[model samples]
Target chain A: DQQVKQNSPSLSVQEGRISILNCDYTNSMFDYFLWYKKYPAEGPTFLISISSIKDKNEDGRFTVFLNKSAKHLSLHIVPSQPGDSAVYFCAAVITGGGNKLTFGTGTQLKVEL
Target chain B: DAGITQSPRHKVTETGTPVTLRCHQTENHRYMYWYRQDPGHGLRLIHYSYGVKDTDKGEVSDGYSVSRSKTEDFLLTLESATSSQTSVYFCAIRSGTGNSPLHFGNGTRLTVT
Candidate 1:
């Protein structure tokens, strides 16, 4: 069973448009959620994160909204650019659990010119 | 960046051969983790170390062993390679906080034929 799930395998968008990726989790023990971006041949890079304490967090064009009651979260990047093309992963972890994180399968987002 | 480094950017070995991937951190962070990335699998944890000689298993620890003899290095050894083990391995360092993000290395691509 997948503790974290990114239902959509990929998302395609045009420049200056918006890209939204979704994630769902089944574990109530998870209190922290994170997003990471990856390029081919490279490891994942930290993106934005939101805690269960809050419903939303934003960093520049990236905003993450978490709905605790629904056990779901979504990442939105406004005015997407070509450089934003990459695989995005949603991960979760339990509080004070030695930082062991479980990740989703990932969603490849392609930003077209 | 948490000053993480993974050795042997790429490796190919035959089945049954022993292979090890090394992760070194200059930050001496207390939390070190090993994760594998593959198609349909974003990043699956294999094992992790909280400190020297203090290690714990992650979700996918089967067939893999990790040793942290020192604060700066974590070694993951595959006792016997298998085709199923072929994937990109990443080393990560966490900030030790309850909800901090993880920093990762470039990753090591390993292929077991």
Candidate 2:
């Protein structure tokens, strides 16, 4: 069984629009959540993260919202650009686990011009 | 930018052959990890090292082993390559303090024929 799940395999949005990727987790022990963006032929790059104590965290154009009760989190990109098109993965880990993350299957986001 | 490097960006070998992948970091981070990225499975940890000579297995550690003799280098070895083992491998590093996020390398694509 997967501890983390990204139900949508792919998402597409037009330039200057908003893109939101969703993730769900079954493990209640997870207290820290993160999002990573990956490009073709490259490894994932850290994006934004939110702790269970906070419901929202923002970093420039990227924002992550966490709903602990629902065991869910979402990553939102405002005014998505072509450069924002990439596979987005959501990860989670329990506190004091030493950052051993459990990642989602990932959602491929395409930002059209 | 995270001072992480992965060697053998691409490799193709026959089944039953032994293979080793290397990850090096200049950040002097205390934590190192080896992860495999597959289409449906997302990124799963195979092994990790908290310090020199200290290592542990992750969620998916079968058929794989890791070693860290120095703070800057971590290695992952597959005892015998199998067709099912074909996937992209990534190396990541994190600082020892706080809940630091991971920084990943470019990745190594391995194909077992």
Candidate 3:
């Protein structure tokens, strides 16, 4: 069974608008959640993360909200830029145990400029 | 972009062949991981190492093996290749910080036919 799941395979948003990507996990042991962005021919790059303790974390134009009770999380990009168009991955990891990441299939975000 | 580097960025081989991918790090981080990215499957963990000669299997470790003989290098090998294993593989590294992000290498695209 998939511990962390991202039901959406793709999402589209207008430029200078808000882009939200959602993810869910089945493992309650997961203490940390992260988002990674990737472009063609490149590895994934770290975006932002939220700990199980806090419900949300923000960095620059990116913000992540975690709802532990629902095992759900969302990534929000305000005033989404064209450069933000790419595949976004949601990953989760349990604390104390060596970091074994469980990733969601991904959401291909298209920011129309 | 982080000190992580994966060698042989692309490879094509026939079935039953042996293939090995290498990940090297200059950051001297304590944790290293291997994962494969496929269409419809975001990124599945193959294996990870916590220290030199210390390793463990991840969610998807079948038909794969890993070894970390030194702190700087971790290797993933497929003893016998199969078409189903064709995918883009990535190597990642992380420190002990509970909130730190995982750094990634560009990736290696392997084709088995």
Q: Which candidate comes out best when scored by TM-score?
A: 2
Best by lDDT: 2
> How high is the DockQ of candidate 1?
0.89
What is the C-alpha lDDT profile of model 3 across B1-113, one tens digit per residue? 88888999999999999999999999999999999999988999999898999999988899999999999999999999999999999999998676677899999999999
- The fnat scores of all predictions, in order, read 0.89, 0.77, 0.89
lDDT of 1 by residue, B1-113 (tens): 46988999999999999999999999868899999998898899999998899999998899999999999999999999999999999999986865678999999999998
Model 1, range A38-69, lDDT digits (tens) per residue? Answer: 99988899999888999999999999999999
Question: Could you give candidate 2's per-residue lDDT for residues B1-113 as a string of tens digits?
Answer: 59998999999999999999999999999999999999999999999999999999999999999999999999999999999899999999999687789999999999999
lDDT of each: 0.93, 0.94, 0.92
Give the TM-score of candidate 1 (chain A). Answer: 0.98
The fnat score for candidate 2 comes to 0.77
Docking class of 2: high
DockQ, structure candidate 3: 0.88
After superposition of all CA atoms, the RMSD between model 1 and the true structure is: 0.9
Docking class of 1: high
